[model samples]
Target: MDFMIAAAIAALLNIGLLGTIIVIYVQNTRLVQSYFTYGLITVASAFMVQNIVIVIFWFNLYTAGPAIKTIVDAAAPYLFVINLAQTVGLAVMVWINT
Candidate 1:
């Protein structure tokens, strides 16, 4: 159950990050070249969303009793895996960009 929940959360997180970029691009008024200008902002926005969510969940667990945190605890492992994947993905993107 925990694994499943984590998987779902991770999946949602991945979709959400990508969706942010896509939505920004779609709504952008400038030419494609403007993407270069937005590049840093886009990456910052994505990272901010990811970290803010992790911090919120981590804080929730820390502040809540175990009984209340039981469900979220189960999802921790999956979140860990996804977090590692996301970190690696960001690393790769940075490498490629540089």
Candidate 2:
């Protein structure tokens, strides 16, 4: 049951992240064109951070039981939000610079 729940949460988070990137990409087309290099750099950095987080979440699930897994799962959302902010901040800086 916990495994199923964790997998579902992971999938949903991935989907949400993808959706967010797409929306940002579309809305910030000007920045993407004028400052695409910087924008790409920011997106790549953000993605690496997010990937590390997802990997850590998986490790926690493997090393800890579902009880702890539950806590990690709860924390994942908050972590995502922080990373999202980081990503947006970078993009915004590039936007402003352009």
Candidate 3:
């Protein structure tokens, strides 16, 4: 029960983050013309896709038992790497742009 609640909360927060990024992207498509900004956009897009996958997995986890959690745990490493790459890319983009 606790795990399900936590996963639900995380999904909600990630959705909010993705929505914010989309808003920013829409407001300034011009930024993506630059190489660094383009990279950021690409990584962010990938992160969004990963987030969607995570949400699906999390939803499944919520309904399923402890065994399903192993799948989610297995994905953690991949998610961590992608998230790290995205974070670094975001920092670089900000540094380069500003």
Model 1 clashing residue pairs (backbone): none
Q: Is candidate 2 or candidate 3 better by TM-score?
A: 3
What RMSD, rounded to one decimal, does every model reach? 8.0, 7.3, 5.3
Rank order by lDDT, top first?
Answer: 1, 3, 2
TM-score against truth, every candidate: 0.54, 0.35, 0.54
lDDT of 2 by residue, 52-84 (tens): 566566666756886686676676566556555
C-alpha lDDT score of every prediction, in listed order: 0.60, 0.57, 0.60
Question: For residues 1-92, could you state the per-residue lDDT of candidate 1 as single tens digits?
Answer: 45535544554555555555445544552545576648755675667576667757666674588686776777677676876587557555
Q: Which regions of candidate 3 deviate over 4 angstroms?
A: 64-98
Instruction: Tell me the RMSD of model 3 versus the true structure.
Output: 5.3
TM-score of 2: 0.35
TM-score, prediction 3? 0.54
**16 Cα displacement, candidate 3 (Å):** 1.9
Q: How accurate is candidate 1 locally (lDDT)?
A: 0.60
Worst 10 residues of 1 by lDDT: 20-29
List model 3 lDDT by residue over 8-45, tens digit each: 45555555565566556655667445666666567667
